[model samples]
Target: MKLTLIAAASTAFMFSLSAYSQDMPGMKMDGMEGMKMEQETKQAPVADAEGTIKAMDTSKHTVTISHGAVPAVQWPPMTMAFSVTEDQLAGLKVGDHVSFSFRVKDGKAAIVSIKK
Candidate 1:
């Protein structure tokens, strides 16, 4: 009967879909992947910091700062690159002292603001 044929076809389709999902890259069978992705996207709060500009790359829009200890984030003095805006780069040069605010996400840092 048509009803019997239809039921068999539906079962086969479900099996094929399950197999396809398992074979795909980054496809999740469980729902925990969503939770992991959410955690990765969440970033720490912005912290106040101060340091000297060790290097600057106007073309890359990045600056390397040899910053002092950041008590708010418990970070020790170190030189690291930070993404910056064109306005932030204006008149700025290496070895210049700067007081700035920054946030770290996915192990990269960026300058949020710079104080004159």
Candidate 2:
């Protein structure tokens, strides 16, 4: 009778061990999934401006521009002279009607490209 009881207790312990082992992979202390990870990518902001060049200053590498309203990006087009790089000024001329792509950083607009 004692041998039978011992065998039954051993079987119960083994069964409980197997059940606990099966659950080990999915157990989470904070009630979160352990094996899944997620990552998000950030996209750069782009704005399009189409306008006529009012003036060009190759010495300062800046251009004065006047553009139509850019409603798609909520930027009201206006006349302004902006600082640009020497490489950007190379292809541009005064009074040229151009469409351009720009990005805003630190409250200033930087021209990315110009298309005639």
Candidate 3:
């Protein structure tokens, strides 16, 4: 009689455990359908470099700047001129303080965009 009770109790416990797991919000069940996972891919945030515009040449599509340190890339503040695409050079002027994003390409800093 004791062995029969023990077997019945164990079976009950197993059934309850399975039911609880199915009700859990985070649990995934095998052979279940219609569960759509919303996974998002996030891009890396753009790094900001701030400084005063030292010089700009719209014709040459280049700008010189003396900027504060950029913490994202561990860059120290220095005065340097960078090349920009002709389209990127629009509406920029020398001596106008600005913030910008750039990446070093072929040992030269290439300007991506300028911010007022």
Candidate 4:
């Protein structure tokens, strides 16, 4: 469909401009089928990376990071938001570079551990 292609293209553009990892397609949860579903649901393996904090919202309990490509999830270098715990967001600020461990489930990334 036209919308799917457009969405895919838009995501690709955004990822191309992102700072973290590079080159792993398929971010939408609604359209996934087969291996795509497997990729989105696979969460046992943790991916590690170092990146700059782009934004954070304590109320939302999420942090946006600009990081390099994460092979574990096939994510391209780009900025993306991750759900975090209050402890994970503590003391971290925009522009702070930190290392973190995370896993992806249903196209959502959740931080397991983080430190500056």
Candidate 5:
């Protein structure tokens, strides 16, 4: 009777461990939880503006542009320096007329692309 009880308890313990392994919290068994969240919280659309480059700081990877209103981001026409990637500044220069795309997050603007 004791051995039979022990055997049943051990089997139940093993089955519980298996169930936990398959039902862990924060572990997406279906693998579509991330995709569902991604589809739900859609990203803000990219915004574009036309501007003249006022200054270019290659060392800082930044550019100051006098841009027209960016209606998408509700920004007025203004001169402000924005961080840019080296690739975006490849052939860009000060005083150049260019159309650019940017995203403003956390009150800081970052230029995504620029073209004359």
Candidate 6:
């Protein structure tokens, strides 16, 4: 009985491997290699956020903001540092309330526009 079970398992494994090894005809249309269409990216839409500036680093051109809940990305209220241009940092200070728009990609967020 044990030998039969092992044979059955090995047979199943070989069948699965063969199924995957078989190439689909549609995968290579007209034999065009390396000319595949650009895969669509799931870029998140820009989200408006409200937060208070908790800290800033001119050298890094970034600000630490404690923001409210963000529904656009389903993120809970949290404090995170966001990258911004030096020009955008002008006229901004710590402890000031502000509104901003930002986009997140690859687990990183950048402030697109900000104003107090």
Q: What TM-score fits each model? A: 0.61, 0.56, 0.54, 0.61, 0.64, 0.65
Residue-by-residue lDDT tens digits, candidate 4, 1-116: 99999999999888878945755576665644544555566547789998999999999999999999988777789998999999888888899999999987667889999999
Which has the higher TM-score value, candidate number 2 or candidate number 6?
Answer: 6
1-116 per-residue lDDT for model 5 (tens digits)? 99999999999999999987795587656866456566567655779999999999989989999999998988899999998988899887888999999888667788878899
- Writing each residue's lDDT as its tens digit, candidate 1 over 4-56 gives 99999999999999987785677567966456566677777898888899888
Model 6, 62-94: lDDT tens digits are 899999999998989999999899988899999
Candidate 2 wrongly placed segments (more than 4 Å): 1-44
The window of 10 residues in a row where model 3 has the poorest summed lDDT is 37-46
Q: lDDT of each prediction vs. the true structure?
A: 0.86, 0.78, 0.79, 0.87, 0.88, 0.91
Best by lDDT: 6
- Writing each residue's lDDT as its tens digit, candidate 3 over 1-116 gives 99999999999999999987785677668775665554433334456798888887777778899999988877798898888887776776777789899877556778878877
Residue pairs with colliding backbones in model 6 are: none
Q: Please identify which of the two predictions, 4 or 6, would achieve the higher TM-score against the true structure.
A: 6
Ranking by TM-score: 6, 5, 4, 1, 2, 3
TM-score-superior candidate, 3 or 5 = 5
Once model 5 is optimally superposed onto the true structure by TM-score, how far is the C-alpha of residue 43 displaced, in angstroms?
3.1
TM-score quality measure for candidate 3: 0.54
Over all chains combined, what TM-score does candidate 5 have?
Answer: 0.64
Provide the lDDT at 19 for model 3.
Answer: 88
Give stretches of model 3 more than 4 Å off: 1-46
* Residue-level lDDT tens digits of model 2 in 22-81: 856665568564545443333347678889999988797677889888665577868986
Residue runs of model 4 more than 4 Å from their true location after superposition: 1-43
